[model samples]
Target chain A: MDIQYPLELIGTFMFAISGALAVQDREHDLFGAGFTGFITAIGGGSLRDIILGSYPLVWVGDVWFLYAIFLGILTAFLFHRSLGKLRRTLFLFDTFGIGFFTILGVEKALSLGVQVEIAAIMGMFSAVMGGVIRDTLTNEVPILFRREVYASACLAGAIIYLVLNHFGLDRDPNMLISIGIVIIIRLVAVKYKLSLPRLE
Target chain B: MDIQYPLELIGTFMFAISGALAVQDREHDLFGAGFTGFITAIGGGSLRDIILGSYPLVWVGDVWFLYAIFLGILTAFLFHRSLGKLRRTLFLFDTFGIGFFTILGVEKALSLGVQVEIAAIMGMFSAVMGGVIRDTLTNEVPILFRREVYASACLAGAIIYLVLNHFGLDRDPNMLISIGIVIIIRLVAVKYKLSLPRLE
Candidate 1:
């Protein structure tokens, strides 16, 4: 009854598409696209593992993840033409990935004995870093730093997860609730075009 | 007899300046500039340590590096107008850093029992990643991926270090010779505008 398998696949695919989309119009060659795609798919988790001193890296030890990334790139390349039409689907996938990844990252950090505050930050970072790196590699200021509710949503979810854990919520139910909140918040923000105030 | 202290300082300053210069003309605020500068200064070494399972990170455990980065950012801010005039000096410092960091990274990986080839790649990565990350964060295709002689020179130095080690050369002498070779190659290449052939 591991719901994580499907969630991980969805997250991986979403991140890969985002990465590929960032470079679709940039005149990058196949290698460039693939490289970007791979980094975007694995960058966050790999960074989290490294920071936590976890060895062998996620991709290095798990060939299946590499296959997942390959599938993501192939989907992006084959559907590059119709990708625009799937914007809604893509948004849903992205929001789902963000929620799932934030929870996963936070839980991992906590298991590694990271302080609760640091673990929450790590969770937010894990959910956001892939896109930040993708944008950076494609020559764009990271969208996270913008007024958007993207990173904030992840942080909020992570804090909620911490609070739920403090209240002795079971792990699986806690994760489900935290992820649901993130997805709902993100969907609302996007639907309403909500944004934080920018510095003058 | 520790040459590493001075080399580390020189490398840190050079990377900070490079990062600052990357954003000098951009519309970034002071915090943005400082964050970019700090990332450029420490990004490479932190990554190398993480991959090699080294703990506490170079900057997190020691606060002096934070001071060095601050100094670097301050210098770049103060001398932004004349930074162009000091290109040669900056290049020299950068070259020194590359050589020193390559050796340091390779030695660390070797001590951790990584395979020789992988360790060499780690060396080049440690030397090149800061600039790569800097350019990426600033929204530019990495210059190292261009037909530049940059990464190749680091690889060459790493290979020479491996060869010297295989021949049972003393560690200090081997590091000195390898570093000298990288610095000389970089200087010569820059002086003559030497570059590898680009793919069609």
Candidate 2:
């Protein structure tokens, strides 16, 4: 398997889990659960592909991508009853997923020769925008609007990766460093119940 | 004052009305109503644009689109008490809007050099996918799953446009005939309460 493929798959699972976990308290059945999960995993990449004018979308190019989404959905269904205590765990993985997505998005866009700044925005968008959309659809207040550290954490991670890549840091070490920063920041925030002040 | 702009604006109004109506019974305030209304109107197009790799998602290209969306939302809010009757009126405009979207979508895709078949698919997608998604996000059983003639009408319109363009029709008549066919089919289906067959 190609390295990019595996990284994308891992990121996909985390995204699906994040999506599935959010609907745990709702009265969703298997289909709805799987549907939402599948959407969450692919939604950001799909959006990125579309905006970049990547025809047929990347998921259309790879079968495992779809299969992985389904796997996440099926797993979510089977585990729904037992996973009520995983908000913190989910958040950690979600942050990890966001970091991976940002790195992947920037790499893909840069490979395609988009400007680095636009690619950076795409990276951050690829990380967190799907959740904003999903929440809005579900009539919930999006975390982007209220959860300061979540997307901001992804942006910080994106900037790190971009700076490291520019300075010729080894790819593996750079990825590790960026991912570690995002996960630590997110986990610490969750662990300490840290949040930025809100207006209302 | 392009013709397509007016057509899209009308479609936006129809789209906003349906979204605004969905939340009439929910415990939403004025801001919530406007937000829901805006999402409903543009959400489908946003999805399509993202999928098609279209940038700024059209509405983001011009703030006037948002202004029109706001107007639609305000209109719906003021008339919320009369919505039961408004549904019938909305259906007429919605069906016309559907026709307009299908024709424009196909035409745009064709201009972009997409294959004719994909262009046809994109056309139907542009026309009907928005409403399908809007319903899904709002937790309503999507009209797509219910075997509504909505998509079928768009499909028919797409094929008609494809055939006419194949026969060398100019842009003006090609659009007119295609739009007319879609509108007629949609309005007729609603008037006669017709639907496609379902397995179960």
Say which candidate scores most in TM-score. Answer: 1
TM-score of chain B of each: 0.92, 0.89
Total clashes in model 1, counting residue pairs 3 or more apart in sequence or in different chains: 1
- Estimate every model's Cα lDDT from 0 to 1: 0.81, 0.73
The positional error of residue A52 in candidate 2, measured at the CA in angstroms, is 3.4
Worst 10 residues of 2 chain B by lDDT: B140-149
True contacts kept of each: 0.22, 0.11
DockQ of each: 0.15, 0.11
Cα lDDT tens digits for candidate 1, B77-168: 88877987988877777788889889888987788777776677679878988877877767768756542477778878999999999999
Q: After superposition, how far is residue A4 of candidate 2 from its true place, in Å?
A: 3.3
Model 2 per-residue lDDT tens digits across residues B3-32: 778878878877887777767787777877
**Superposed model 2: Cα runs more than 4 Å off:** A27-31, A86-89, A197-200, B1-46, B53-129, B132-200
Q: Per-residue CA lDDT of candidate 1, range A1-200, in tens?
A: 37777668768877887787667666565545655777798888878887787787655555567678878887887887788688888888888889999999998899889899989998998898988877777777787976369999999999999999999999999999999999988888888999888779
Q: For residue B168, give model 2's deviation from the true position in Å.
A: 30
Q: Per-prediction RMSD in angstroms?
A: 6.9, 7.8
Instruction: Write out the backbone clash pairs for model 1.
Output: A139-B139
* Docking verdict class for candidate 1: incorrect
Per-residue lDDT for B160 in model 2? 97
